[model samples]
Target: MKDLFHKSLSRRSFLRYIAATMATTAVDWFKIEAMASTVEPKSDYPVVVIGAGIGGLVAATYLAKNGFPVTVIEQHDVPGGYVTSFERGEFKFDVAPHYTLGLSPFLEYLGIQEKVELVKPPEFFRVITPEHDLILPQEDPRGIIRVLSEKFPHEEQGIKSFMSLLNGLLQEWVKPFDMKTISSTHPIMWNLSKLNTAQVFDQHFKDPRLKAVLCIFGSGFGLPPSRLPALVFSPGTAASIYVGREYVKPCGQGFSNALMQAIENNRGRVILKTEVESILAKDGTVTGVRTTNGKTYTAKAVISNASAPATFEKMLSPGHVPDSYMAKLRTYRPSHSYFLVWLGLNKELRGKFKGFQNVVIPEHYDPEDDDKATSACNASKTRFQVYIYDALYSGYSKPGKSTVKILMQCGYRPWKHFEADYFAGKKEAYRKEKDRIAQILIERAESKVIPGLKSMIEVMDAATPLTHRRYTKNPEGAVLGYEHSMDNYWIYRNKNRTPIKGLYLASAWGSPGGGVNPVVRGGQSAFTDLMLDWAKIK
Candidate 1:
């Protein structure tokens, strides 16, 4: 039956089904291919990249390989922004990313597949609620449908239909559709992009618990189903279930280090611990960037992987930015950040939850209420996502030990009071608040997910939203850049190309939005845009 299902629902049939469902006229097969051929340097024009994040690193590596002299400036000591790791005792904990999908293709394209090792978990995630405890299988869309159907037999048809829709959408997305031509080329996606996740789920399902269970991925984006755009949710969830999710073996730092090494191998330079003070512009065109150390590097173009607010409001003079662009930027809201608690257990947890990388325990089944509680920083009411790194990878911790991390979507407003002091090294008050919040999360996890969780700790560390802001320099410490709301949908958001000439955005704050996969694509897109523009120079 599974073999028959695969044969019946071919790519052509999927497209046909999607076209009929959306009532679109036709599906155009015009794909935007990246210019992979190398070009000789016409002039000594170099490119300056701000931020050494994954996006910037990807862009710089490609540009340098294609005969462009590239230099990346990063404020942090390490290259990876949020995709980094820290050591506590003998254990290493990933800073942000738990597991990522769609990164293998990027690593393969960049010829760094062998440099990094990716491990896929047995399951995508385990969702736990008061009423249901479900496991979403990894790389098995049909299994997901079957599992959910068995759980809620009444909504079986709806489950199949929704999963099928998602499978079709994933196909369209992986085709690497041109963002500019997506509306006309893929009308189904364009239409879906206009609606929220909840609207799409409501159309197919009747059970609120089923919808809630399916909406687990929404928390990863820091938005509930009611606000997260269908375009983001549909393909993201599909990819995790179908294409499969993977984690960089050891930690995310290895992934970042590999990319940085690739860039250096291609003659790109990365300067760490240097902040880009301003993006120098003349005659409304970006000329170069000046570091906070009073050093200036002249380049023909600049790609900023920094936050949108920092790029426009802090890094550039007001006169350089058009009022209209600033207005649109102001209207867009950044996504919620997170407060995390990392604990190193003296005893191994592999015997308890085998092969489970992530386990989400939600206090309430309703995602809307979860979002509200999270935004309010009410730890008791919000959900807790626990990551058992040791369960997935054997070497994640010391012998007979485990590394666990618990986090939830937390708003920046609640941590605003500690921002100034936190960065100034006067963390007395900040530490008190963060510790208090961490205790709440720890206590909740101890009672709900892991019994005697507190007693197993050998090392403990915590980070607040303020810590996120300081490390990544993101506005409000947004985890996923701008919120994936209808107001800030991909079509409405700023693309890789900016209003100012020779300036581009190549980070989560830019087009294609956030997540490890999208940001890697964003980096490639920014590089493609810059290369295309440079081609027009002579």
Candidate 2:
């Protein structure tokens, strides 16, 4: 799970890499232990955020902007948690190829609109299926309808109805969400909340292939339609697709740097490489946090951007969390992880590539089968997104080369067994397994879209679920955090508030769920809740 080249990059090396990023604008922006009897006295900050993920950074930035003393602590040397980038040779690969929305409004609100660049990707992305190859424009519902209707003329009315419904849902459902007026009682959303994506699709269309195409966007949530909550799928996946802008950073470093800049400019402290040992609390209220390096930080309020399960099970002691809350956390399941292949090619693929973001779904991909196979790491029927950054933007690679990132949803089950003692002969097997899977995935990509893709590779590195766990320490490497299922969509999505007062959750796992935009929104919600609580203080 370490770097592809190094056994363990030294602290100096980490500093060098991170320093380069920081110097350039990589805004280098987790969990718990026991309460200590004696510790040095420390001045209390108004807010202390655990984990420097996008959510944490956003919350910290807001608090600092309002003139509250805030500090963010991260386990990693860099900031941005899932929004990070890693360098290998001349190429820098984004940890996650985030398609962002709400960046403009967020930055504009912070009075830093011009400070960050929200680069729109090439207007279109292609979906390759057995029966059809569809090139859909970004945020264009009619384009999608035209394509689908043309592909399935017999289902023209169905396609039109589906697309129209999605568009209408966008104007009706998503606006309230953006305005923060959405509630569990909202009639339309409440009804939508009860339906799974598959159920909604069934009512609108019958063609299996067409349904698959519609469900592809929901895959961004790391689940197939059948299991995906309609509320999550409709607004963001289906409807929001027409309204939401799609973007890719030349690299996320600059974006992260902008966030950190916003925070520091507001007088917030972003502490790196400082792992939070525990969330300090007394009498059901948060005291602060203690770090691994024997340093204790005192704060009136704390927000955790780490995984939800880890925050409760590992970060807090038994009494600090209530039995009911613990029971709810226990019921939550982490979402699917990913198996990624980062390739630095020897040649530019722009001329040969058709789209900035490409998806390859098997000819007769069944959503149910896709859900099963991918979660089990079966590449045979796996659906994946091929993000050719070089095609989208030029500065990401050397003059003649390009960077290709291949992502497939995979579960941690297959990779977890490899964590046995290395000296006991498990290491080589793990390495070979990673290589084997990477080869299969590469072959899949080559066979489907790019012929001779293996020959073009100059540098290739792969990441398993284990790598994700090792880096972010997310439980089971769930990249998007806890799954957003119908069960949790309305009543159970963990909110910013916890049983322990003044300790709030602010990560992908929190309410509003995953994706960079949602996490940022979650952070804003956490900050809003904190402000409300603060106002209530007599």
Candidate 3:
């Protein structure tokens, strides 16, 4: 890591590298479009997509628009897997995704931009630690540099260098790439990809507090800086600083609804409240899927947006997947889940907090220790992110009221004991445990960020890992799919294509891993690959 940092390239060399990568990306995009235009859709070549998550939805919409018959099957009553929202009395709360990046272009591509309203937070996010309270500016990299430089004057030059590196990484991330050669062609990116975020920070700064400040966003990927891939961390953090973060109006459900509507308008079908019992295959090739009600949907191909474990181990018949594939799958672990508390406050919190949409309060400056506490189920030592809905925009709740959500990274092992009973609908013990944890999180928030938070609550709801698993069907309720460590980086993980022909993956479980933005691109890439495959069938 030190060697790479010591040999930093000149600014001119960096620009030249970026330009080459962008040109390669443009060529790849044109190739995809040319292939897509040449493929003639067959009326009988129907496609079945399992799960109505953003990835599956985007893929189905593109296929349907391109003249192939498409059908989406979802187990939940709603369309969005984890992106849906719920109502509590007069207040509404988003289930997951407080704010998202790269949604505008995606929505516009689906032609539903007008239907969904995205509101930028007053600031990117507010970070609070024992020693400092800082607000990072939105869409202003120079402002961010100024703020951090002022806060940590001694590390100003280091901050500037780090930000410049992140900016370059962000440019690379947004463009297309020839995945086969990206590592070899982009040496800087390749070198940094081998190190964790913490290792990269050590090369630049001497202040632990500054490192902590820069790394708090790692929680968005469900890992601490010590374990998160520096390549993955750079693009996301840079996007937040330069492009800014936006919250969906009403809730994330509105965004999901827009995509669903786009699919329907394009003559696609979205089946809800129906579980896919198994993926039908004959002679080691996917045929279609069978629902829980014994209804069979025959198609030429199938795309599974379900968790990888469920897709390979449970959905398919035993021995259908190759032994080596299953062996590799076993080595990958799911990312951490969350313990969330959604509150419908009787009084508005906008004025009190000065209209801040998001606030992150860590227990201390050490993320590694905080991660350990999370894995150990120690709420006192864990950090939490608070989302104030009313603060983002007005009319989020009834007059004189507001909605807030508190979330913390939580391990699934502690909630395993309640899994059986919770699934069987006997949730007494599960509810008791969840309530206890919720109270601890609420009290921590009240003491650290919101004063008298408990008293203002009109309705309170808490969800455990079991709840997330039950709803999303992600094993252990892993929010970001597989752990995004250097060992399991995107390039090393499974891509959209699978060992079995005609069967594809489009979800957080697939390549270019999680986050609404990456998954959307994953969906598009899956559709592109599927279409290319079909074009060759003649």
**Which candidate leads in lDDT?**
3
| Pairs with steric clashes in candidate 1 | none
lDDT of 3 by residue, 432-498 (tens): 8888889999998888778899999999998888889989989999987888867777567677889
Query: Which lDDT value does model 1 have at 344?
Result: 90
Q: Model 1, stretches more than 4 Å misplaced?
A: 1-5, 8-43, 174-187, 361-363
Number of clashes found in candidate 2: 6
TM-score of 3: 0.92
Q: Compared with the true structure, what per-residue lDDT tens digits does model 2 show for residues 201-265?
A: 88878889888887777778877888888878876654234434545455676667777888999
- TM-score-superior candidate, 1 or 2: 1
Better of 2 and 3 by lDDT: 3
Ranking by lDDT: 3, 1, 2
Model 2's lDDT to the true fold? 0.75
Ranking of predictions according to TM-score: 3, 1, 2
Better of 1 and 3 by lDDT: 3
* Residue lDDT tens for model 1, 1-538: 2231355455455444433322111222111123324345524768999999888988888787666789999999999888999888888888986577655555766789998899987687787777667787877777887788888999988888887677566546534467789887777787798789989999899988888788776668888888888887886676566556788897899999999998898888999999999999999999999999999999899999999899999999879999999998888899889889999999988767743644454645788888888888888888778888876766667789998898877998888887777778898988888888889889887766788998898999988788888788898888878887787666575688999999999888897788876677678778777767765664
For residue 17, what is the lDDT in candidate 1?
42
lDDT (0 to 1) per candidate:
0.79, 0.75, 0.80
Best by TM-score: 3
